[model samples]
Target: MRKIASAFLALLLATLLGTAANPNPGYARVISAGHVEGVLPDGSAYVMDVPTNWNGTVLLYSHGYVPDGASNPARNAPSEAVRTALLDAGYAQIGSAYPETGWVVEGAMPAQLGTLNEFQARFGVARRTIAWGTSMGGMITTGFAERHGRFFDGTIAMCGLEQGSVANWNNALDTLFAIRTLLAPGSTAPLVRLPDQATAIASAAELTAALDVAQTSPQGRARIALAAALRNTPAWTNPAQPEPDANDHDTAQRNQFGALRQFLQTGLTWRQEAEAHASGNMSWNTGVDYARMLANSAIRKQVEAHYRQSGLSLRDDLAALAAAPRITADPAAVAYMIRNISFTGGLTTPMMSIHTTGDPQVPVQTEQAYAEAVTDAGRSRLLRQAYVHRAGHCTFTAGEMLAAVRTLEHRISTGQWPDTGPLTLNRLAEEWDPAATHDYVTYSPGPYPRPFHLHR
Candidate 1:
């Protein structure tokens, strides 16, 4: 009897571990929380969790960028808190590690679709499915809505770069270019046409060091302010610290400096990676008007104040920018960025975007551009956007996320948008998880500094 029991136990383990997905990858297993882990046909690994009391729903998650060296690809989730909470709430969860990493949208979209297919094959299709993504994943989620909307019930894009890669990369390039032109002219940062990946990484670190030294001097701070304004980077950076006091020019400049380094350190080096993927330079500053950009900046006064304190000539600096040679985009690369993907605002699914108001990296302005896409496509009613009063990219509480998810779910179920105002959502979010502060606030972002798109 003991020998028979041991053999049965071994067979159960083999069935759980070996039969996770189609063809049974053999490494797949039944983990804690009744989760199944396996690999897909495209070499993308996948995992799905089903609660004891399944709610007939699945949340398909797409994750953000993972650097080349650090591509774990073990799990796909926006955050651990969201994953644990959603699974506990009886919603089935599934995600896939993309076949490649680092700004890999082309691979992400299909990998996600395959994961959903794998999920259906293994556990059977849920009654409803919602796709959610963060950062780059959010961008992928947007594309999914455009290309494959009928598959999911709805989508939630948190801190997404949904404004298309061409425009977004150009924006990042503008900031890094300004940093190079204004602070360290010809400092070997390799803004575009990066020689290699190692040089690209080194250049980013070099720029970070330069920003650090620049912050100590008034001249450096003023230039940084100008660059931030041109880049449309928000003056508030550190989430741990409160927003800098208005009229505190020094502190504000400090905040801008922090924003530049905090976000751009990684952003600066990404051009090389982007160029490799794009097949040429996709960013250009040839015709950008420096004076006009500064004039329109919300932080215009802040830049002027910094220059005045430094006893520097803002006009001269602007003149210098006007005279500086601009980077030109390769037509082929620009075509790749465009033809590869562009948001037509043709989201067939009811979509909701949640963003932090003070993100210097993926600015809140991205949502503005995406709104235009939706409006232009005549699908304005299908989209709703909400924001959190926080700094940093994708820095959202699980409660805030759940509230937005619930809001979107309610809209899908009822075919009507609930009170999406910040106050209502904040109150609702607080009701669910009081420990996590919910600061969904009424806010509208200004124009994105750079935009490039051609949808056919």
Candidate 2:
């Protein structure tokens, strides 16, 4: 009898290991295809894609904002990369270009999921679906999950803005104000020396006028110069690295500035489109407007008031900049800083969020805030978080990301929670000393009081 019991236990262990090693099949042979259009409730068109294989698990991907609506529907290279990874792990993926290529989460979510539902119905498969996005896409996914939790089995929000209403608006306002402050009258003088006071004033005037023109211009040249100046100048107390020219600029603009512009442009366009539709312009889907309105009541008023206070005069700045033979604006290259941190608690689905500790664009603190919010709301059991030690924006190694994906897949498939051990800061010695027992602190300008590094 004892031998029989031991044999049974050994068999159980082998089965468990086998299940972990070969949990899902048909994950191979995943193909990336594109340009599929999904219809919203209003019959207008939106675009999305499907990772081939119909794995009974669908991911409704929300993309980060893009300046042009046409760009939103454009297949994201990263999304394609992730799709191949998911296919290898045995999952289907789908994503949408938000309405008009703006941050119209309300409209876009329905259109995307509706399309997925249609696909499922057409395929006759009863599969679980997930929602995921990065940055602005993350924010929208959080909102959708909060309202329509029943539709999804889980949500993976990366660097998502979870706070809503005043917090969200204020965060945006603060970032805009930071950019405005960086360009204020005395801001650029230290970066470039002028022959005289008149030259200094002329430069400031030029910059201010150029900004105004860029604001209304379809292309974003003046805005790009402003970004370059902000990057180059160390006028502010907490100075960010200046924009690099060509080679070094890859990480700065490609990742940081590029993401910022996409978010701001997409978000702004989405808000405007939503407002237009709300005020009886129903020809296009106004679902985004409804969500934006619900998110914050005073967004427009606050932005306008701040814009007036900046006194940067976009039109005047643009004219001044144009007059400068050497200076040119690149509207496509404007950098946006993330702000207006907000979150929605009481999530119904299990969530696993991860962010790098050394991320420059979205601070690690943002991730902590989200995790804390989830815990405070009494949903800690339903959430998990992991922190990587890498730098830049969401720049985890492919192997690290693959491990995360596998863990997530296992949880979704078997209802078994994967272990996310204690979070550790990468390159600990560079940032902290476990044995030294020392204290360190870093500071930023006013309104940004959080210590950046306390142990380095």
RMSD of 1: 7.3
The candidate 1 region of ten consecutive residues with least summed lDDT is 1-10
The CA lDDT at 181 in model 1 is: 78
Please give the distance, in angstroms, between residue 36's alpha carbon in candidate 2 and its true position after superposition: 6.1
Question: lDDT tens digits, residues 1-456, model 1?
Answer: 001134543543343344243354434666775688877555568888888989888888888888777855656567787778777788888888876667667666666776776677677768888888888888888887777777888898999987888888788887887787788876866778886788777888888787788888989999999989977777676699888777887877877787788766678556777778788898888889889878877789999988999999999989888888889999998877765466778878889999998887788888998998788788888899998989888888888988988998898899998989988898878876788878999999887776554433
lDDT tens readout by residue for model 2, 362-440: 4545555455556667777767666554445555544444444445566677777765553221222223223322111
lDDT of each: 0.79, 0.43
Error of 1 at 389 (Å): 0.7
Candidate 1 Cα errors over 4 Å, as ranges = 1-27, 186-188
* Number of the predicted model whose TM-score against the real structure is largest: 1
